[model samples]
Target: MRRVLSGLVLLLAVLAGTTAAAAEPATETVHYTFDGPSPLTDVSGHGHDLTPVSRFGGAFTTVAHNGGQALVFPSPCHAEPCPRIALRAATTTGLNPGRRPLRYGASVRLAADQTTKGENVLQKGFSAQGSQYKLQIDGLAGRPSCVLVDDRRPQIHAAISNVGVADDRWHTLECRRAGSRLSILVDGVTRGRATVPADLSVSNRRPFSLGGKGSYPDNDQFQGILDEVWVRIG
Candidate 1:
């Protein structure tokens, strides 16, 4: 009987050890909390520290929720050049996971502050002519539109015309990448879809950012709330 009991104890101990070893540690999540009726100061988890891109008085701010954060950028950059709030990745370590055929995701609510510029919106990824991919949302005249640039050539093969989420409410946005096909969904609906040949070489090396490009000094910038930006690999 003693031998039998000893054997059972050994088996249990081995099982426990195996369970502990197989468990995966939780990934760290960073949050930049905010409250309504207030201005922004700092944004976190961008992998890099942030600096105000415009001379505006406030920084990007957020509100805390469910261990996550809400982000907001105010607009009306009326100067000769539209004002912009930019977020640069801290370091490649945790920011760029190097997952090719990368799966980019986020939830955002945006408006184009194009009082002067022709268009207003938010843009992400690199915009170089022939190397990188760009994902953009153009919210102009209180209308929401999405565009996908598969190659740096500024060749836009797919676009969603009337996204229409101009209200001040929060909207969910998601993008999926597999091989040469890039699919996009807004507010949980399929808005725009495109397939790019692998030869184009759209990749996951360049860092992620918010705010419009500065190609033209008078381009538009985004205004409103941006929340729950994340990336997932499946």
Candidate 2:
């Protein structure tokens, strides 16, 4: 009887441990396949709508990519002024991950001649306010690289990847913020990382913008095809 009681106690302890682990919050993921209806919608059931900024003067279309459909941003240049394709959500309440650890992933393919200066791939927040962060490619020194910028503080924190992204090729890009460390990954490989404040929070009242900041000009627009865009937070 004593031995059976001891075994039961150990089994109960193990079950309790497993239960606690299961109680932890699961990773929340928002994926945008861009294969939905016109105007693009988040298929992850998050109900985030992608709206185009008409003032930028660029149209969003679906093009071919990886044997499927992907959102394409044609050059926004006409003659004198070439605005970049801009699309963003009206609110960041359920879209943003707040101050918790989060990861942003996307499969992107740049156009053959899409090397525009200061072109942004993904960003959240405005330039006027100090609470903004961005994940960009090839916006630094005209090189094909991944850049993560955090502007929540007085000094801007940027983490740039060492590997250069090839043009006209599909590549998986990811930026992860775990604790105080921000890491940039290319094709599932960690390329760059920067140490930020542990309490650094990316929370902002502004809406989350994609392709580029809504208030900014076309110089920072993104000229490429983006697919499988997702944001995971825990």
Candidate 3:
């Protein structure tokens, strides 16, 4: 009788442990569907407010994309000292996903006449010197490509897509970092992947900029339309 009782207790304990593990909170996900009356706000209930980096020139305007509103960056007066939109300080604090896995995705459409070489679409960090990660539609070899960079010197580990993305058509670009591997996907297709430090983390007090990095000019500004930006942290 005692042996049967012990077996029952062990079964209950195992079941309890499984239940507890399953009850753990899922990943935190934030999505921005640019449907708004004026200035855009994150509809993901994450409280991330998009603000203009500059008061004047670089402000984003609302345009239609896929039957929804999208943020558009008009032609800038100059490539350097251009205006940009971003979420700074307090707004970016919750983006710290610790050392766990994270993913960033955006729906972008390049202008038909896009002549710029390096147009930054999304980035998290203060400047090139302080960059933790960045995703840009750049013309590295005189051809448009989607590039993803982490905190690496010379960026040799940066992931570059095999196909060009600046076709003036809407495309979904995504970067996912899991364990020590980083993968870049364009339109649900894997573009490239690279191995990064297992302990790589972007948990810092830096502004998460869209359209471009606030400090850099010339190559970091994005001139196009952006919609449905999403971020997930596990």
Candidate 4:
């Protein structure tokens, strides 16, 4: 009888351990889906007087031929490849920047034939003049696949890379920042790890984009589909 009781207790302990592991905090999702003739209308505090660019400009829009709206840059700051998807820290109306201990994740469909040049699909510290940090995705340019840089030391800090992520297909990439340690995920698998400065914050007041720019390929135009961009805070 005592042996039977002992076995039952052990089973109960194992079940409890499994439950605890399942309850661990997981990455959450924040999506800004887009679709329409006026695709930028989904964002708040936007006005009608702003100049329009192509079919996918303003705040958000669906302007690509891939049956989904994209963040389009018809006429970029410089001038084919200039199309891009950008994110800015807009606080006029004051929306809470989600939770703390933030992690960023995204599922993107990139242009199959051509991809971002000079580095990886992920680039940081992107200012028209210059930036403090940069994460370059170099596989798009026929280079070895890896996260190019972690440029967030001074003002810009903590850059990550999902090394095996490729364009022309849907991929899920994630970056987790816990204290000073950083972990990157590509296709739902952890690919790289790094230590970041405590003072590092990659958030810039300027807007950041995907697909198009002025630095490479005449204009940095992103030719693809992107969806399910999620920023999680632990």
lDDT of each: 0.49, 0.69, 0.67, 0.43
Q: What is the TM-score of each candidate against the true structure?
A: 0.60, 0.81, 0.78, 0.51
lDDT of 3: 0.67
Clashing pairs in 2: none
- Candidate 1 Cα misplacement greater than 4 A, ranges: 1-52, 56-58, 63-69, 79-82, 91-99, 111-125, 139-154, 203-206, 214-220
Error of 3 at 161 (Å): 0.9
Q: What is the per-residue lDDT of model 3 for residues 8-75, given as tens digits with 9 covering 90 to 100?
A: 99999999999998976467666778886744677778777676665345566788777879888857
Best by TM-score: 2
Q: Which candidate leads in lDDT?
A: 2
Name the better of 1 and 4 by TM-score.
1
RMSD of each: 6.7, 3.3, 3.9, 8.9
Query: Which runs in model 3 stand beyond 4 Å of their true positions?
Result: 1-26, 76-91, 126-131, 140-156, 215-219
User: For model 2, how does the per-residue alpha-carbon lDDT over 1-234 read when each residue is reduced to its tens digit?
Assistant: 999999999999999999999976666666777774553677777777678874546676788766668888766363655655577776765545556787887888875467666667777665456455667777423233333334456556666788766467788888888778888888898888888677766656676666766634544777777788788877
Output the better candidate (1/3) by TM-score: 3
**Candidate 1 overall lDDT versus native:** 0.49
Task: Tell me the lDDT of model 2 at 153.
Answer: 62
| Residue-level lDDT for 114 in candidate 1 | 31
